[model samples]
Target: MSTPDIVLTRIDNRLVHGQVGVVWTSAIGANLLLVANDAAAKDELQQELMTATAETAGVGIRFWTLDKTISTIHKASARQHIFLVVKTPADVLTLVKGGVPITEVNVGNMHYSDGKEQISKKVYMDQADKDAINGLIDAGVKVYIKDVPEDKEQVLQKF
Candidate 1:
């Protein structure tokens, strides 16, 4: 199996919005947007919405369950440049553990919720989120927080 060229892997709660569909996709030169989220995959409406957004951005999009993504990602065409996006750090960690060659992760937008601490202006995390990110770092993944391509990359240190 040959894996597609993964240009960028990002953790953004808002799966395929303007920043992701237009800015990050264009910046990374990814022809395909692979959204690996279990909930999004099962939600037909969300898939349709995200697909529309990706189409407007002129990029192909796929919403797959984490299991499917892990099993089938390597089967993608080698010519395909994939930009993998997921909702959380734990998802990223799952993909990595499942044999996705994700060396670096861009922490984009993790919204505030109960029990979640504000790690940065645009990021909030609870204990599990922090542990997942820390695990990624320990696995030699270069995890950084950057909302957009133009923003400065903030390397995440284990907390």
Candidate 2:
């Protein structure tokens, strides 16, 4: 099968669960799912878990480390539709810092953490998270919050 068009979404929880596999994918018509996370890609257990979750989505899923993902997306020889997802603000930052070509970011689900303050009912941002997100904004990448397909998307600056 060929790679599909990528719909980039930034979800902080690290797992591409229900809202992602079913809701977002269906809405965006994603056929190839790319979940970029170092720990999960390197760990057999986590990979297995992610694989299991992906199997139910009726989409081709690939787990990639930051570097591999960046290269894949950057390659001129490679072209396929992809639903690109990264789990953290840091991952987004990493890609930007590495000069990965990105224009937009969509927040899906970022769970509550000790230092994380709720930016919205479905979103939260720690100071560093804010800075990282803002950095993406500074670099001209659009950042928005939408926990699921049906939720309203708010620009990160509004937070």
Candidate 3:
């Protein structure tokens, strides 16, 4: 198989914010931001907001559900540079289960919610989140927690 064009896979709840829209996009030189999120794919307002943010960074973006994302993996891989973003570890698990070749995943932000443990400044994990991360690691996908390109990477282990 040929090498996939997707250069980065990130699990960021704030899918296309200032950090991802500008810093990460420019840092990785990724021309495309493929947001694999079911909710975002159906929400017009959220889609518009993300698109506007991506435009500010001069990066193209497309939103798709887990199934659609898997189906279009071939075409997305043909693009020059793709920065894949998903909302949760569960989403990443879905993609991996669907045969997406994600060698690594960066956990940007999970947010501090009720019944969740603080894993990092920008990442919080509930039992389900922890389970999903473990599943990905077992699948041989390296997962790390980092807010930005400048932040030190924390390996997403059992926690």
- What TM-score would every model get versus the actual structure? 0.98, 0.87, 0.95
Clashes of 3: 0
lDDT by residue (tens digit), candidate 2, 1-159: 223245665665766776677677778877777888887778887767666766787877888899987777655224445677888887988887876767788887787889889878866779888888888888898888877767777877722
Top lDDT hit:
1
Per-model CA lDDT versus the true structure? 0.94, 0.75, 0.90
What does candidate 2 score in Cα RMSD to the true structure? Answer: 3.0
Writing each residue's lDDT as its tens digit, candidate 1 over 1-159 gives 886699999999998888899888999899999999999999999988888889988999999999999999999997789999999999999999999989999999999999999999999999999999999999999999998788899999998
Q: 14-112, model 3: which lDDT tens digit per residue?
A: 888989989999999999999999999999999999999899999899999999988777664465698999999999999999988899999998999
Q: Local error of candidate 1 at 60, Å?
A: 0.6
TM-score ranking of the models: 1, 3, 2
How does candidate 2 fare on TM-score? 0.87
Candidate 3's displacement at residue 158, Å, is 2.1
Q: What is residue 110's positional error in candidate 3, in angstroms?
A: 0.7
Q: What is the alpha-carbon lDDT of model 1 when measured against the actual structure?
A: 0.94
